[model samples]
Target: MLAATKRVAFGAAVMALAVGLAGCSGSGGSEADEGGTKGAPGAKKAPGPENAVRLIGDGSTAFTGAQPNITPPQRLKPGEKPPQFVVFSWDGAGEDSQKLFSHFRQVAKKYDAKMTYFLSAVYLLPEEKARLYDPPKHDIGTSDIGFGDTQGIKDTLRELRAAWHEGSEIGTHFNGHFCGKEGGVGTWSVEEWKSEINQAKSFVENWKTNADLPDEAPLPFDYAKEVVGGRTPCLEGQKNMMAAARTMGFRYDSSGIGNQIWPKKTDGLWDLPLQLVPVPGREFETLSMDYNFMYNQSGTTSGDPDEHEYWGNQMRDGLLQAFDRAYEGNRAPLIIGNHFESWNGGTYMRAVEDTIKTVCVQRDVQCVTFRQLADWLDAQDPATLEKLRGLKVGEAPRAGWPAFTATDTAPADRTEKH
Candidate 1:
């Protein structure tokens, strides 16, 4: 989800004048809080206990696509049930896809969690395959970025089949994101949407070429014959996404949310909408201020992870609140879609895990993955899908938005991690 460029400018001013990214201590799953405010240099403070306890209800994760992108008769698509699952997808970031894929598998085991993971063809490298447990224990989903000039679509997913099985499921992450621009944002003609959609479909359906990655520093591989049956990137609205999904032959899409374009007239696409990911108070300014701050502060990005500590903590706290709201309210369960690169095997992922642990154990909360949710939904009658939260105005929250005391002071710029 992209913010307006105009709002970005205002945020830049706040960062430069009010919060010049004063360095704060950084932690990777470690419990530590550094001093944040009160007119002094970055200092250390308490972050409280590891109170990662029950805080919400049913959870699910969706990757761009998973467990064999478009499997052949993989037990007819499950019937519909209550859509309550968690989804986590990622573009193949840099060259650490395997590291990330392996790391999360361990995390999942520890929590007794099952999740669907979307993988770009690039991630199915020899290095990545080597890390996999025999028989492919993890759920592998496919996300193709055809917008990139290099890797071909069929060649991308074919690479996955050659690398691993059982865990592989082909699905589309749409054509943007890993390719840049659009970042999955929309406003394109439906035809343009079809062109990209069809390209992914064609690749997934016909990827039997059995090609190999190019011999280069960043390995680029050819995909085998495979077809993707799902997609979830930048499908912000119902009509656009519905038209696209129907045209593209997608069975489901892990896009949309209660907060995004909602209360739509159509239910053509199955939505695995993400929840309100917490952004930092200062992040709004980071994007707007990156350029100016580089010149102002020793040629560097203005809001490094160290400088944005409080926002991080606050976001972790807020996610718990969000989980609480969704569970306690009449709304359906919260499904999450997070980018692996966003966490990149670091403190951020741990923070999210902390929140997840807190929520999964909650009295009402029952954690699940997109596959799990879809299986549950598939088993139910289609009518149940109509009764979901993202389809209409979700049940109002049990608690009102926290009433912040607004003096004459301006609202502090805010952002949360997705």
Candidate 2:
């Protein structure tokens, strides 16, 4: 393990802030942060219906921590700021025939960017990166089915289901790879959406339900978790899709990147928005403005030294850009996007490796996963989440000292929070 960097004072700060949080809302309790500090946990009210998700700082503040394990240097330093630490993530976390995942993992390992790759069609897809880690940072995944060929999508899902026993999670990647700008992410027919989810779950979890294996070898991922923690084909930000996801038993979706807060069209599922990943965007000039991007080492790449050269370099720079923005704007996390297939091309892998090296050495940033972020939010005071739900600079009275822990009754409500 890379030498653990000295911890930050966020814990102490959190405690102090919790007091005020408790003031405005009735949320209080203990907190556990390794060698940090311990406070109180909120009282467990009746588990509200899915739509009644009432928790402070829920989903507002998060850390997307993950990177492929095979890439080169990507270490994070203490007190490192975003651009680097403000990590985002990609679903379909797996090693393809081109060794894309292995390459990206190297980037993750170096930067300490704890990424969570959503596993899906990576099952029998192809092992471009030979002799890879059995479970490639397999956290949760989307696009379980729909491999385009439609040929063995079913068989492939079966093998993946076996891995699911260990730690691979499944989510929706789209009804049938129906991606692109105009794709009907939130506007898909109800039955079509239902079929997409139902099929993926059924095929992906075949071993779980019909397994005759001994109980000792538990599954790798959680099938019962509704693993719907992903986005659709296109980056079409829509409320209808959210509402549909909720109705379909999904708790979260990584579809919305730019937009913050639970959209009004929520179907009760959590929106984990996909910010920007490392893959190249539009063209050369479109590089710098590449705030939110996706990466895959399997596509066409530019060797342009500045912004176009190796996508890896561009991503490193992008990380810096995101950090500056978050620090300047107080944004807690930065979500990047990518695809398993994207990392398959020629130069793409090299770019991924280089980018990984850049992220590993950065400081102050804590790479986290979607689930971890949600958990982090779940642990925070409800009021804080509300205040941050739709973070806007002009929205006077930003988060400050004396972190409020109590949401049910907080002082901020009277003064500025509300």
Q: Which candidate has the top score in lDDT?
A: 2
Question: Each candidate's TM vs. the true structure?
Answer: 0.50, 0.53
Candidate 1 residue-wise lDDT, 1-418, digit = tens: 1110111112222233333321111000111121233534665443433221221111111121223322222221232122223344432321232244445544654654554545432222222222221111112322222121123322333333322233323354543322113322344456655655554433332222212333311111122222223433332333465576665445456544434211222355456544433234433222111122222323332345663444335545645555554454433555544434332224345555676666656553446545445545555433333333223223432222131111221223111112
Could you tell me which 10 consecutive residues in candidate 2 have the lowest summed lDDT? 20-29
The best candidate in terms of TM-score: 2
Q: Please write out the lDDT profile of model 2 over residues 1-418, one tens digit for every residue.
A: 0010111111111112111000000000011111212346863444333213221121211121121122223322222221223334544443334344444544554455555555542232222211221211221232213122122222233323332222223354432333322332334555555555555455344422232222222223334353656655444434555655566656666665433222222455555654332222423211111212222221122323343445445555645554444544534455555554432233333443444454446554456655555545554444455644544421222343223223333445322321
User: Which portions of model 1 show Cα errors greater than 4 Å?
Assistant: 1-84, 91-98, 121-170, 176-187, 201-210, 213-241, 260-265, 277-302, 342-345, 361-364, 381-418
Q: Which stretches of candidate 2 lie over 4 Å from their true place?
A: 1-87, 106-113, 121-170, 180-187, 207-219, 236-240, 259-267, 276-312, 341-364, 389-418
The 0-to-1 C-alpha lDDT of every candidate, in the order given, reads 0.35, 0.37
- Which run of 10 residues does model 1 get worst, by summed lDDT? 22-31
For model 2, how big is the CA root-mean-square deviation? 16.6
Error of 1 at 363 (Å): 5.4
